[model samples]
Target: MSVELTPGLILILGALPVPLLWGRVRSIYLLALPVLAFALMLDTPNGVFGQLELFGLQLTTARVDGLSRFFGYAFVVAALLGAIYALHLKDTVQHVAGLVYAGSALGAVFAGDLLTLFLFWELISLASVFLIWASRTPQAYRAGMRYLVVQIGSGLLLLLGLLLHFHETGSLAFGHIGLESPGGVLIFFAFGIKCAFPLLHNWLQDAYPEGTVTGTVLLSAFTTKVAVYALARGYAGTELLVPIGAVMTAFPIFYAVIENDLRRVLAYSLNNQLGFMVVGIGIGTELAMNGAVAHAFADIVFKALLFMAMGAVLFRVGTVKGSELGGLYKSMPWTTGFCIVGAASISAFPLFSGFVTKSMVMSAAMEQDRFWVWIVLLFASAGVFHHAGIKIPYFAFFGHDSGKRCREAPLNMLIAMGLAAALCIGIGSLPEFFYALLPFQSEYHPYSPDHVTAQVQLLFWSALAFAILMRTGIYPPELLSTNLDFDWFYRRLGRSAAGAVGRFAARIWQAFAGAAAAQTSRIVEKLGSHYGSGGIPARMTQTSSMVFWTTVLLAAYLLLSYF
Candidate 1:
């Protein structure tokens, strides 16, 4: 069959000009583009097309398959919601950046070869950093710089790994890779960094909170989800990711609990959510892969919704810090309700999106007899409910009623939140719609009585624990201080180390200059003493004594020769 241009591709490419030419238009086009893209993606065929050759390397620009379709659908939905959330902002830079970032992620998922994936990967990094920078604050600028550095670093590693893999395998196809090879390991770390694996997670927290309200919405959707897609494509079933993902799921809770910045807390929560997908990839079975893809789909929805709610607060209240916000429900009841829906979904409450999706991954873990893995995942689930599902809304809307009476979010923001909240409910009520899009056949049921009862018992008990802890003053309250993460190494210790080295070098240079000056002074003083006008050597050397001595030596030499 002849290659055909997909509607999704057309919409994505066509939307590029909306921000460029119409700077004054409201975000209507932004909201419409993703919906159009989704409409087009639903009709596209599942196969490779639009092939081209670059420098003798075969590149497939459009390759639609089950896995790619899953992620592509999520991207379109996320972009739509993000555009709705950001409608109040007039900065065309962020709007354009958000579109390009979304397009690139979609393009990356559908790419048929490693070279194509790498190209779109770098495009995402380059395009998305502008979102953070659009905040127009010094902290945002610095955070954007760090974000760019880490993203570019990931791109470089990915490029190097692709080249090495091409050399080893003589092909550039995107497929499963084993960690036994050096190239595979390089590729793994590239995905790991974007996946926010442990120490590499600093960029998410550093940059997300610093972004403009609209920018953070876009920031939360595409970057890490794309990384998750890449991992699902390249490193499925790699045993190492199991433990790495466990740590990713477990450790972010402590930080999120104590974090004062609501957006940063969400960023930590985002890291924790990625762990579920990572575990699915590690399980490497058909059902597990299905769970991963489904969770990723659900994650993009609810996470964007949460960010939307938080972004709306930032738009109205001028801050998203937990300590600075409270009692918003009175004035912004619509926003408060939407936020609760998002929180319910994230907490995996029954009849919510996360309930339908996250349970698949947990079920997959249990199926594999991963006892410890299941236990860790259970604790992480509770942690998710504790930090993101409860604490975020609790502090921002209901806690302390800080007497701040801000207006509700813009019309577009509420519409976006409403749309997302509806989807969260829709997906939960009918998971078949989501299950049908999975990479593998779906045999899992999320609503069994035993499963529902068990989850409720676990999560409700966790909530009770949280309530008791708070009532007795055992639970830590959000403070007005920054919680340190991996970025501390570079932001704090790294800069301090550089400063100390600079100061030490300065002191060494001063010492060397002083010694050189002393030596020069001694040489000059000795020369002046010996060669001054009144000095004996100065007076005699230029006089006849030198001429007499030369004449005597010459006469003696002549006499001796003659003898």
Candidate 2:
């Protein structure tokens, strides 16, 4: 309780000695950082601390309130889970990067000023990229680079917007910054990029699957959630986000349904889930805000569980492609069961985490008369069940037998997944305790007859539809082929277009150079004809001609001077 340091610093600083410590000492040290941070987070009271003034501007580095407190708890818990999940690895880079990344996210959450937020915001990207690169594959390398560019670009946009906002308003406070000014709009897009806004979301799917197995789990828990927290803090009630979030929710279902890579499917699913939170933030009502925050917390748990499950498959069988995986339950029964739990949670099954949290946003939309938004969310919910709820578990664990036999996930991974599954069930089964931690007070019930009945029916019909599609051979088959998304515009199409233009430009340059070279050669030849060893100037009369010309020039100068 007497600890003066914020929890974020504790984790970040504690990671310093990780590389030097080895064996059980290192593992203990790694696990203790998160535990200590969590304890410090819980002990810290609600208030602002670590205020400073620089260049005549006030800054609050640590702001503890309901919103920050909620995110902080989730982030710290994620770090602890990640640490446990990664405990068996000898990869110190991952451990350090994961800790620092989680700490940076917490730093961003607690930041009370835009400047402080920006500082932590950029650090998150720098630290998390190592997770992707840790895979040590060329594909992972390229993905990490692209992911870094987008993430750092987001930070730069945030920085530029905050600076402009400071100049216009003479304040850097992190509060409602609706899209009324250029600065606010820039800031909005910056948050949108991180939130996986429609056209700006390719990075999430592109990079997350490329990370090391445990790395992907850590990556899933931080960046977007912090972006969500930032949006809730600064851009809440911005109506434009409603439609944007709706688009986010709807489109990824199409991609996820056909995505061959199971991890990539989850990545798309992550984008879909974020849409619910984004919609809640956009609604800006107390209930909507509560829904957004609550869903984020639940999502961190369930999503991680799902990713951990797939990660385990990737670990044991060396692949997560649905086309190549089946009958895995016999080998990894615990993992299979956990993956199903995750699927149910994400699909919003009654009495699951997603059901309890996601419904709040839908209810808020309905209350706000956002008829279309509510409808799209409903469709998205079903679509998620179709792909994520059934597809992930079915193909990976129960579909056509791939005859791939392997050991279950490591003890650490099983422990981590079990804890996450427990949290999902716990939060869903006992809503009051989790609801109490929400930013706003609410009496909303997630288990009322209407809510329960509708959710169950939606899930049931979604599952039935999936069965019919599979039975009738109408479902999209998972194939080991690339599925293009918005990134194709830049990654393939844009690159090709640029290459064409570059070639055209290069051809024009070559033509010009050739013509210039030809002309220069002609000029040089002509000069050689006149002035070379065999030319007139080289002949015996050259000295006389030169002297005559000099005499004529002298005579003309003398005549002009006399005149």
List where candidate 1 sits over 4 angstroms from the true fold.
1-12, 19-28, 504-563
- Candidate 2 Cα misplacement greater than 4 A, ranges: 1-5, 508-563
Per-residue lDDT of model 1, residues 1-563, tens digit only: 14354334554575567656654354556667787778767777788877788888887777888888888888888888888777776787877788888888888888889888888889899988998899889998999999999999999999999899999998888888778778888988998999999999999999999988887887888899989999998888988888888888999988998999999999999999999999988888888888888888888889888998998898888889898888899989999999999998988998999998888888888988999999999999999999998899999999788899988888989998999999999999898877877788759888999989988998889889988998899987777897777788999999999999999999999999999999999998888888776665567755576886788899999999998
lDDT of 2 by residue, 362-436 (tens): 999999898999999999999999889999999999988988899999999999999999889888899989998
lDDT of 1: 0.86
TM-score of each: 0.89, 0.91
Quantify all predictions' global Cα lDDT against the true fold: 0.86, 0.92
Error of 1 at 265 (Å): 0.9
Q: Give the local distance difference test score of model 2.
A: 0.92
RMSD of each: 6.1, 4.2
Best by lDDT: 2
State the lDDT at 535 in candidate 2: 80
